[model samples]
Each structure stands twice: as C-alpha cells, then as structure tokens.
Target: MIAAGTASMGRAATPGPSRWPRAIVRLRLALRSSEAAARGGGGGRWAACFRPAPVAGAAAAAVKEAKGERSAEVEVEPARGGGEDVWSARADAEVAQGGGFPEHLVVMVNGLVGSADDWKFAAEQFVRRMPDKVIVHRSQCNSATQTFDGVDLMGERLANEVLSVVKQRSGVKKISFVAHSLGGLVARYAIGRLYEPNNRRASSAGKSRDDVEHLEGLIAGLEPMNFITFASPHLGSSGNKQARFLLLFYEHMTFKSLPFLCGLPFLERRASETAHLIVGRTGKHLFLTDNDDGRRPLLLRMVDDSGDLQFRSALRSFKRRVAYANANFDHMVGWRTSSIRRQHELPKHRLLVRDEKYPHIVYVEKEVTNNRDTEARADLYDPEEEMIRGLTQVPWERVDVSFQKSTQRLVAHNTIQVKSYWLNSDGADVINHMMDHFIV
Candidate 1:
C-alpha cells in the first residue's frame, strides 16, 4: 500500500530509454531479491512487500521472470471447483458463498504494510454484527508472495479472487470491498484492468497499454458492487513536507513511474503538474518505533514527496468503479488525498464518508500507577493523563463501524479491538451496512 512516499503523476522521458531502463530493471530486480531475502529468514530487514494485486481463482501469474531462475509456481485451491488456468475463474467452494447471506459478500482489503491477519479483528466484528451474511478477506500478495514485483501479478489475480469468493460463498451474487491505503489502489487497478473496455485488436508483439487493458477487461467483467477505500491517498501529495531536492527532481522528472511499482502507467510531465495541486496538511502520529523489533525506521513524519501519483492515476483511471469510501487516520495516509472532491459527475455518489478524529484506544490503554517515570511528554491528553492515574475510559472513535459511507472521510488513526459478542460494535455495523448494499 502507498502511504507517505514520493511518486509524482506527470510524464517524462526516462532519458533515451538507455541506461534508465537498465537501471530500473536492475533496481527492480534488487528490490525483488532483497525484499524476498528480507521476508524469507533474513530477519525482516525491509517493510513487508506491497500486497499482491487480486486474482479470481487460480494463483495469479507474474510477468515472466527476467532471470531464468523462475519464482516457485504459486498454486491456489480455488473456492470454486473449476480447474481453469485463468486466475479470475471461480471455484466450487467460492460459489457456495452465494447461498443465503444476511449481508452481501464484502471482501476486506487491509492497509499498506500489513496482511490479511491485520484485518482479523475487523473481520471478527463483521461476523458478529451480521452472522448470516458472508464476510470475505482478500489475500494480498504479502500473505505468501515475496518480491518487489508481486504487484505486477495482483490486478488480474484480485479480479478473479473476487469472483471466486462470491461464487463459492453460496448466496452472494456480487462482491463489495472495504479497503485501506495501498490496498485500495491495488483494488482499483485490478478492477479497472478487469472491467475497462477495449475493442481494438492489437498484435501480440508486446505488452501494449490497450492490449494489457483488454486482457484486464476480460477478467474484470466480474463486477462487484460498491468499492471502498480507507485512508487511501488517492490524490497524491502536493509536496509540502519534502525537502527541495526531491521536489526539484519531481518537477524536472515528471516521473510517470518506477519499474518496481505495479499497475498504473507512470507519465512524467503530467506527474509534475499534479504535484502542484495538493492541499498539504497531513496527519501527525506517534512514531511506531519497535514496530518491527527496531529494524523498522520510525515513519511518523509526513513531509513533502511522501506520496505517489501512480496510485492517484490508478484511482483516477477507474474512479467511477468505486461507489463509496472511508478513511483511517494518523495511521500514515493523509485526509486531503482520500476525498472525492464532491464529484461533479456522479449524483448518486458523494465519493466518501469521512470521519476524522482520534481513536479512543490510545487514550484508554492499561495505565501504570507505579512507574519510575521514563518518558517525557509535551502535554498529556485525556486518555494519557488517565493512564498516568491508572484509570481507563471508553475510546470514543471505536464507537463507529469503520465502513460507514455517509461522510467523505474517516479519521481514526488509532484502531481498538471491538468486542465481538455476535456483532454489536462498529465493525459489525459497518459489515451490516455492506450486507444491506450487496447481499440484500
């Protein structure tokens, strides 16, 4: 998932396509190999690779390895019984989900730098709120895949996974989504490639845009209902926090893309123009130090050049495909990029239902009464002050189910585990709303 990083939306020539392509290829390869090493017994040196794009059923395919040393062929047990090679084809098990769900099949996509396990708590809440409905999880590339290019295989993979999930779920005829951060971008790219129309007949020479798009459309015909993105930076940054060098490169480079990035096409000059349009007040968060045994750098600050326009381009390509939206805050993504700008085209959609605020859990953590006073504080808030006194309070932001679509943004950067007593909390409520939209 794209959080705070630097990628602009404009197009620029990669300088004669000479050394740049080779360099990109080399960089991409190194990123892939190093990331794999980092993931596989390397002691977690890098952040987890971005989640793989979606697939329908068969394990999604990758761009044929540049190195003859191919990746281990991935095999997936399709929920559906079909044995087709196409990733989007449904399996028998997935078809079963169509039975009689109280809610629709809402596939949950987790945030950047996380996995399906990350949404386990939220899924539990959904199940509790409406047990009769089917709640699905989109297994991203991060769950099993380990490569910088895993995203290269995601869009088609996800396109099919949605079909299989709904087909096997018994009563579900269509699928909906609840996504966070880069997961949303991945989903959009997958959906667009799968659903976008292209009738022109192109040669099998190379992976041309129209050709790639057509292939994507063939898979995306499996349209699901109401796509949602949480705290996803759809608009890219305006370059407020970045130092001068990166901004300068962004202006001159018009960087349409990086070889490592998956999906969206990176145009150079267009990217520069887009960077100039940001509203630039990103959220602030307590840096998550020790998040990965101290190997992970603290990423609490949101400076300029901290976002990519590739995701924004991907989102823009199929903005129409998304029906509703939500956001989580202080987690990494900013509020400005997650908006719909109150779409002038779609009367039925206002883009997002944004609920920005402090999460209640951080305030109500277990308190220490006899601490020797280790850390310093600028000014303590309610829950922090309460914690110092060994007291707790109900986290208020934990009150809402995360997927509510009534507003344009949701600002809870801190998420608390909701009690799952057969679905009584906000997670459950959000799931219920999804059910009403899809399964009903």
Candidate 2:
C-alpha cells in the first residue's frame, strides 16, 4: 500500500472551477469503494481501481483503420456541460445526415463520473426506431467541472444546455430527457430555472430587441413532454439503513462530501442540507422521521472530534441551519425540493413521481404492460465499464413510466430498483417503452 505521505501534489493540467478537486477525489474514492466492495475482504484491504480502459482507445483506433471509410455511422461526440459553451454548437451535417438525429430531439444527461458513451445502447435503439432525432450529450462528464467555468454547480449549467439543444433542433415541438444519478439534478436545475420568473427578470429590464428575442428563444424553446432518470437520487437515497448510516458517517468524517454537491448545475443546490433533510430517513422532509434530529449529533461530534474538512464542516453548519432551522432536506434530495411536481398522488402525465407510498418507489412497473416479453435477465451490464460513457446509448433503456394514464403508482424510492433493472438488463421492452412515449 502506498503511504499517505508518499502522495504527491501538483496542479491538475486542467483544474476545473468548483469541486474540481472534489470530483477527482470522489472519482478516486468511488474507485476505492468499488475495490473495497469487490474484494469482499482478505487479509489485506485491496482497493479496486478501475482506471480508464487503456485498450479501448487503442481499439477505437484499430476499428478506425479497419473500416477504411474513416467515417462511422454512429458518431461518438464529446459531452458538453459545466460550461465550455459547446452545447449550442450544432451537430455536423455528416452526423446529422440521413438517419442521424432523425426523430424528435432527445437530450441525454449523465450521472457523475459518466460520459456520452454510457448511452451507447439506448442511443442505438433510438437511432434504429426513430432515426431522425438528435440526442445531444450534456458534457458535464467531459470537464469534470473542477477547473471549467460553466460546468460548476450541478443542475444550472445542465439545464441551460438542455434548453439550447431543444431550441437548435429544427421542427422540434416536444423534447425528452433521460438522466442518471446527479445528472438528473442537472436537468432538474435547468428545467426549474428556465421557468423561474425571478431568474428571467433580466429580459424585461431593458435589453436590445435581439437580446430579448434570444431570451425568448431560450425560454420558449422545446417543451419537455417526457423525462426519465436512472437511479437518480431525486428523492436522494442510499438504498438502505446501512447506506443512510454511512452517509451520516461520511458527512461527519470526510471534508470532501458537501461542496462536491453544489458544483452540479442544479438550481438552488446549496450544500448544507443535502445529507440531513434530503436523504436521511428521519429528517423533517423524508417520510421517516423517527429521528428528527438524527444528523445534529453527528455534525456536532465531527466538529468537536478529530479534524474534519473545513468545507464539509461549514456545509454541516449551513445545511443544519437551512435544513434543521428552515427547509429540512437531505442527500437524496426531497420531493418538496426535487425536479417534480408535488401532488397527493402521482401526476397522470409526468411518469417520474415524488413517491410517498412505497420503498424505492422510483422503480418501473416490473410486470410486462401488454407488450411481448423478450427480456428474461435483470441486468447484464458491466457497471465497472459504465460511468465513463455518460449519456450512453447502451440498451439500458428503462421502461417509459411516463404513461399518459396513471394506472400504476410507484413508491418514491422504489425507482432505484426499476432504473437499475433497465440499465442492467438492456431490455427491448425498456427501449420500446421509452420510444412509445417519445413518438406519442
């Protein structure tokens, strides 16, 4: 094992602005966590580090050479988010020609440490079924946002890109969204902020006609008729009491936890209350309130005990005040503060609901819905090879829970399992369900 002292520090060749270090650190920690989980314990604690595949890039080169045409039917474009201002850049005609981007416009957002390649199979399905639609990747994964200007903050930047993509696509009346993990937050922030009159007051405050037109264009862009997220922490969950407990431990233990959240483009993504009010089962916001002040003791103890990260400590204090004293939310995000329309029952239109009745309520209806049953497996994906291919077209097309009619009702957190099953299985039913909604 390498000594902690042996670690060397040099500036990142390209340090992103917010949570730049946090993303890198989280990326490392996630790798370590994956390894630790994989090891299942031996005499030594081996950290599983799934460094990016070296051979994959080489293989891409080899395929390029063999094809001889030097062109690919499927173009793997870089994701754009956290601000490099590339989202507005139009898809090239070659990439736009014929079958490419032929259907209704689909804007895909990825989870943390994920990339466009992540959407590979789903994109292929969309391309085959609805060949005219353009599915643009939200590039937040590419910059990792630590040093980049626009990429910082979870949902804000992501929302902007989504708007831009929808507006740019010709004849696009309806827009669809598919996001995973924190990527959902990014989309949420964008969608929420776009409609906020407070956020759009600048338009009426004396601007040029051209500026006003651009503003209107941005605001009135394509309508978000359908939305889907994969295992997103929308109602932010750790899946179990153990995960919930560990999140508490991490908040008090790790310095890197809190600020990492605010870096996303999510609207109003303040750090302080994430763990306590959003994800915590007992916080004021969640359905489970057995421990109303559960997180308080942990935060106080962390500050009193051994040194904790300053940013984290500050967040603990901030979140405590905002959440405990005011809003009362947590890590998994609260339905009251999520990208959903709150209701006594699931909304008949938007499929992604802020569930109140079931465990892991976000899961899709498991039983087949009058369609041919072709998939038998729950999941066949290599989760390790994922994360890098952000808005992957991977067959992980989940069920289109965005049913026009709401006969099925899902518990809030149950979505995790539903999403997991689709992403893991890459089933045709899942793809077809999404397509059904998109075309409809």
Candidate 3:
C-alpha cells in the first residue's frame, strides 16, 4: 500500500516539463523586472512576482481520497499594510460545520530569495490533513532582496510580523514554526526576541511540575509547540566541509546544482569570502563572516542567552525541536551543519535504510544532549565547533534525509522541503513523514 501510494503521488505531483516552460519564462521575466525596480529603490515591486496562487495540492488530493471527502477549502489572507504576504490556510469545512476556528497557529517561513509562495504546498497539506487542528500562515515579510539584510534585521521583521498575526488571530493559544534553509536561522533569532516568561504561572504555585513546565515561557504570548527546520544551516556553512571536487564535479556533470559552489577548495574559500557580495548580509551570516560591532558572529552568540534576547531559553521552551537535514547532494548546506553534529558523529552508511512509510528519511537520531560543562566556553576561533557545542546544550531530534537515489538528488536542499511540487515532487514522502510525526 505504501509503495503504491508513493508511486501514485509521484505521478500526480511531477508536472510535465513541456507544460511548465512558459510559466518558468514568465516568472523569470517578472523577477528580472522586480530586480530592476528594487535597484530603483522600490522594494514593493517584488511583491508582484509572488502573488498568491492556488497551491498545487498533490498530497492533499491523496489525503482527500483516503478520507472519502474533500478537505476544507483553504482561505488566503493577502499581504496588507505593507507587511508580509500571508497565505492563511484556514479550513473552510469547520466553519460550514459550525465549528470554531482552530487555535493552533503554524507559521511557515521561506528561505533566502524566497516568498510566502514557496510554502504554499506544505501549508495546504497541513491544513488539509488536519483542517480543524491548525491555521497555517506562510510569512512573506523578508522575501526577495529584503533577505539581503543581515539575520538580526530579518529576525526583527519576522518577530514583528508574527506579533501582528497573533494580534489578528485572537483565538490562537499555541504556536509552532516550520522554516526552511536560511529562514531557520531567522526564525531562531525571532523566537528569542518573541519569548516572554509566563508570569501568571508564578502566582499559582499549586500547579504540578508538568503544568509549571508547560507554562514556563510563552512565544509571542502563546505556548510554544514544535520548532522544525528543513536543511537549515544550524552550525553555519563556512567551516563544514564536503568531499570537495569529486562530488562537485559529479553534480555538475550529471545534475544541475547551484553554480556558486562548483569548484575546488580554493574556489570554496573564495566563495566564503565573496558570498556577502552575492546574497548580501545573509551570505555573511551563513558563512559566519558577519561581525557587527566587533563581537562574535550572531550564530555563536545565539547559542547562549545574551542579555534580553534569551535565544537558548526560547529554544528550550518548545515542546519538540527537530532538524531535518539532507545527508548528501545538498551543495548549499553540509550535513554536519544542518544536523548540528561533529564530523565523527554523522550516521554511518550501513545504518541508512529506507523505511516503508518514509522512503527518503534515511536515519533518525533520538535527542542527544551535550555533556560539556556549562561553565566551559567553546573555542573562540572555531565557530563551527563552538556552534555545535552551544546548540547541543539542549537535546535535538535529528532526522537525516537523502535523495541520493532519486532524480531530484542534485537539488536535495530544495527537494528536502519539496520547495516546488513540479520540480521536487519526490520529496512528498519527507513532508508526509514530518506531518505524521508533527506534535500538535
């Protein structure tokens, strides 16, 4: 049944190449025009390139067939007040059935150069699967060239965007974040700024330990649930090394991968140095080259709570924290960085087996806590090692994904998140695995 379902999904999801070329051409033209407008100091022109369209619901179609009925129609609340474009996925069936709207808010964030449209498919899947359980909001505050701003500034915008959403959704009592790639880092920073201690719990002392724990902190004044990231560079991307030229050459020879990273070590070194010029401050942050105010890189400082930002504390408050990493063929992010592990800690090849239910998920590691003493500071120079040490202070569930055998392997970074249904439909299994294991 699982195998059949997989095949059916793949067939339904992958769009024919001949059918999408025109759309691609139009999109490219729109982006070029938007780029020109951006250069002319009009940032808002980029919005036209990402107008919300009906999400291609390949996974939702299968879900509807299984349930013997259509899921609730999703409603979109477009961008307003010059804020982020929000794809609000509300289940319409609940309203028809006289049910109150869902109180759990799921915020979906896009990666660098991406818009809220990037998360449309996943947002639709989430709403369709559990129409009454969640309200998925795809955030668009820092899309396009705006992502060129440093992580700190992007994070501030995200935090404010979230707050505005919460204000509008008065019934939402719980919150979760699902972010992709560089957006994961932005979400992490935003969470720190959004965290507020639950002072009401202090006044009520008779609560059980579990109750007290659950009420320990609030993110944007709502209980924090799951914090999940796909192919996120948690440990930064600079120092982490891949197999180099052999893999780079192989990817170029066979599949289309990111052009910025297709050379030898010297090129890799050069890319690290000049990344900021291409992608702006985000590139610096990803490469761990950002040093604002002569302090350590923002990622290193984020490992521990520095002053009011409570980065680590906000992270620990979540009920579950998950990092989904691509095991290979993800030229954009290295496995060591995404999974937040040391060089030797990566899973051995022998352990990677395809689960019948989740074909692409190769290995799952239970939460592991760092045993390093809290008093000890990480090595100052080795930021990657320092980040690993700092982030592992709290336990994290690591999920390793591999598209090595699939045609989509070359774009494993985007495939891991199923960024586009037509191009990365094979990753539907990965998205299914995430939703099936998602903590409500």
Q: Of the candidates shown, which would achieve the greatest TM-score relative to the real structure? A: 3
TM-score of each: 0.37, 0.38, 0.76
lDDT of 1 by residue, 255-329 (tens): 211222211234222233332222111111111111334332112111111132122222222212332223332
- Scored by lDDT, the top model is 3
What tens digits encode model 2's per-residue C-alpha lDDT throughout 338-373? 322122322243455423332112334322212222
What TM-score quantifies how close candidate 2 is to the native fold?
Answer: 0.38
Higher-scoring candidate on TM-score, 1 or 3: 3
Give Cα distance to truth, residue 37, candidate 2, Å: 21
Model 3 TM-score is 0.76
Each candidate's lDDT (Cα)? 0.33, 0.33, 0.72
Per-model tally of clashing residue pairs: 88, 87, 0
Better of 1 and 3 by lDDT: 3
TM-score of predicted model 1?
Answer: 0.37
Better structure of 1 and 2 per TM-score: 2
lDDT of 3 by residue, 1-440 (tens): 32343244245334676654453445444445545553664535433432222334575564442223434365566643233322224545556678777878899888766778677667777776777788887888988667768789999999998988888876777899999988899999999999876664333333454765656587887878899999888887677653131122222222323222233465466656666655567667777778889988888899989888989889988888999999998876789888998878899999999888898999998878876743445545566777888888888999999988875575677778777654466677898988998888
